[model samples]
Target: MTSDIALSVKDLKTYFYTNNRCNKAINGVSFDIRRGKTLCIVGESGCGKSVTASTIMQLLPTLSRIEAGSITYHAERGDIRIDQLARNGAEIRKIRGAEIAMIFQDPMTALNPVYTIGFQIEESLKYHTDLSLKEIKKKAIDLLRDMGIPMPEKRVDEYPHQFSGGMRQRAMIAMAMSCNPKILIADEPTTALDVTIQAQIFKLMDKLKAEHDTAIMLITHDMGVVAELADEVAVMYMGNIVEAGSVDDVLRSPKHPYTRALLDSIPVLGQGKKQAIKAIKGATPDPYERPNGCSFAPRCDFATKECDVMPDEEYISKSHRIMCANYKAVS
Candidate 1:
């Protein structure tokens, strides 16, 4: 892996086994997260965005298995193949919170109801560092203060329920950053927040990334968030990445049919009054019943007999690539 690349995922295939049928949650997904940069993964629900995040964190359910692919983690000292590490091994345990941390979608469900927020943060600090109890508590308070929490000394001792939704999200960010992780995997981090609060969270993440030199792999469906924070963007459809490039390239000049349809569906302000948001014609295909050729062919208007054979990803520029048979037809 190059020095600029913090993490690289290649040919990742994660599947779930249930009742003798396999659900291909993530098939051949690949992307690179550059150091001190944000790579946003955007797609509709059930399109394997979250699954890819969880697979990187090794947090999948018991029945799920990574059938093929490798996740290379570029540590300061050397590179480690994360896929080959045992789920509960010593190295992975150290890597989870210390090297890579995840901020989940929901703070209410992610936090433990019993423990105080300070204790939770301290737990992460203790696991990653050999800090004493007093030092850990002080660091926990510092983290809360850094996250803009008021009365950090007192609020740090309160349970998760005592904090507001935005506060709780900040607390989650504090915990995820307690160890100063190299890579931060945020899965829909602002899903449950209001618009104003959402902006604050994005700003906080950007500030932290700049200060800590951290790489961010953000999974979200919000194009607004992508526009505000993403350096690179990858569009996923039915478990495959259809297009990937710099944020401007992917959002401004989308090549794939699915990518264009998604942008068209976004409601543009000041375009006109009383204009209904455009909706895609069909829903995503069932995971187990995906098409043999192009998984997106059934719903793609540009799909034709040529699409019967899956198209290889073609590079349009040094950093832009699209997986489609007729990218030129649309653009």
Candidate 2:
């Protein structure tokens, strides 16, 4: 692992078991989150972005379990390795809030409707910090005020329902940042908000990152967001990562066909003669029925008999990689 790696996920496989059959939700996914940088996980819906994030945070449901892989956290205590599958509740509890903090996709649902925003933020501080009640309250308002909430002194007393969707999202940011964690895992943080508000949230995150040097793992489907915020990008399809690389390498010159298709599907704004975006043809295959060879072979335009042999990872220099037989052959 690199000296600056804050978190390293190696060959992660999280599966769900039922009486009927077993399902693979995250298959052999791996990436590194470096200190003080952003790594964006991008894919269409049901691509296992949330599952990967939840697995790392050890928040998956009882039915689903981590089948393989090692999550290693490098800290002052040295490397803390956990087999996310076998970790006890107490161990997960320590890692969840103290070192890693998560911001959910929906603030309204994640935040308790009964509690005031101040109470929620203060609660996080109280759990993680040994501050007095007065200090916690002051920090809570400072967090809200720092997130640009208007009159945070007054609004901190308001409930979740009282704030607009955007404000609620900002308040969620306040709560997530209250502990000043080393790693912030945002699972679709800007999903429901409008574009302008989405922009603001990202800008705020970027500002905070610079100020605190926090490592961020952003899980989302938006390529624009990936282009804007990420230093590196990981593309997942049907629970498996097909490509991973630096943002400039992956976005500007994608080796995998799936990555190309995803970027091509985004509609262009200023090209005046409006035309429909070219979307990928097939829906993601069922998790229980994933293909035997390459998971993305069914949808790839460049797939071949080689794809039926199960792809292998090919390093395109030190910074770019793709799990594809064809891209390796041609590139």
Candidate 3:
């Protein structure tokens, strides 16, 4: 809605239709990513975090469709409603991997094994720009170098398998950043890496953001990662954003029960006594069989009869909001 907002997703509902049953993967998801800031989406597995990223990138599979809502991208040219762009059409093509890029969860799966890493990076540049093959190749190697790959001139010519996991991840980042996209969507990019490598990846992303002023939509379940990079955090549950605010507001003064539960579950360093780790009770509900009312009401400790109907989104502050009936009582 504002010039500073790079991307805004409003009430997005992405569903999978199979056997006449609809699996609501991302129901009523909304958030804003501002230019040069990182917005982290955090939740447990199957909470629709990754699906939300895929939807924003217009990368949803055949069975999936955006059933409702809008994804608006604020470009230098003008404001564009991405949801209105035809799937995989020329308009969407101009945005995906160019103006808006995504780094997927697994580089091995996302990268083409048969193609050299340089070719892959160049492919994006070639598609989006009118650069010559030689220019694209030179830019590709430069991107890899920027990503901190050793001797990127040599490594760029190597295939995905030749590089280590960390290297491959870096290559993926290089490819995503090749076009200097306005928005970068990274979906659990550090999921398979060790703590050290994960830290390195985040640091690289932070450096990229600083240099490029890129708005980042980071989808991760790790609270630690969220702590490291997020300016704002959105805690999603059962396809709904139950809590959202500045990182400190959401992490330190979380009002929603779900947010509190999530924070309490994170294992702390030097946590004094030998107490068992805290974990949220109950599993995520089945997507196809989501219950009426609050999807988390079944597991919420403070659920009331009022929870049988989804509560109105209550603002704790201008930037802090929660969709819980008992937030006032709990906080």
Q: Which candidate is the best by lDDT?
A: 1
Q: Evaluate all candidate structures by whole-model CA lDDT and list the values in order.
A: 0.93, 0.87, 0.91
Question: Once model 2 is optimally superposed onto the true structure by TM-score, how far is the C-alpha of residue 72 displaced, in angstroms?
Answer: 0.7
lDDT for 324 in candidate 2 is 87
Q: How high is the lDDT of residue 168 in model 1?
A: 96
Point out the higher-scoring one by lDDT: 2 or 3. Answer: 3
- Local distance difference test, candidate 1: 0.93
True lDDT of residue 297, candidate 2: 85
What is the C-alpha lDDT profile of model 1 across 1-331, one tens digit per residue?
4889999999999999999999989888889999999999999999999999989988889999999999999998899999999987898888998999999999999999999999999998988899899999999999999999999999999999999999999999999999999999999999999999998898899999999999999999988888889999999998899999999899888899998889888887788867667688878888889898888898888888989888899999999999999889988
Pull out the clashing pairs in model 2: none
* Model 1 Cα RMSD, 1 decimal: 1.2
Model 2 C-alpha lDDT per residue in residues 1-331, reported as the tens digit of each score? 5888999999999998898799888888889999889999999888899998888888889898888888888876878776643555676676677788899999989999999999988887887789999988889889998999999999989999999999999998888888888899999999999999998999899998899999999999999899899999999988878899999999889889899888878886687557667788888888788899998889877889878876777888798988888885444
lDDT of 3 by residue, 1-331 (tens): 3878999999999999999999999889888999999999999999999999988888889998999999999999999999999888999999999999999999899999999999999998988999999999899988988888899889888999999999999999999999999999999999999989998998999999999999999999989888889999999999999999999999889899988888888777787667566788989888888879999999888889989998878888999989998787777
Error of 3 at 55 (Å): 1.0
TM-score of each: 0.98, 0.96, 0.97
- What value of lDDT does candidate 2 attain over all alpha carbons? 0.87
Give the higher-lDDT candidate: 1 or 2.
1
Give the distance in Å from residue 16's predicted Cα in candidate 2 to where it truly belongs. 0.7
Error of 1 at 88 (Å): 1.5
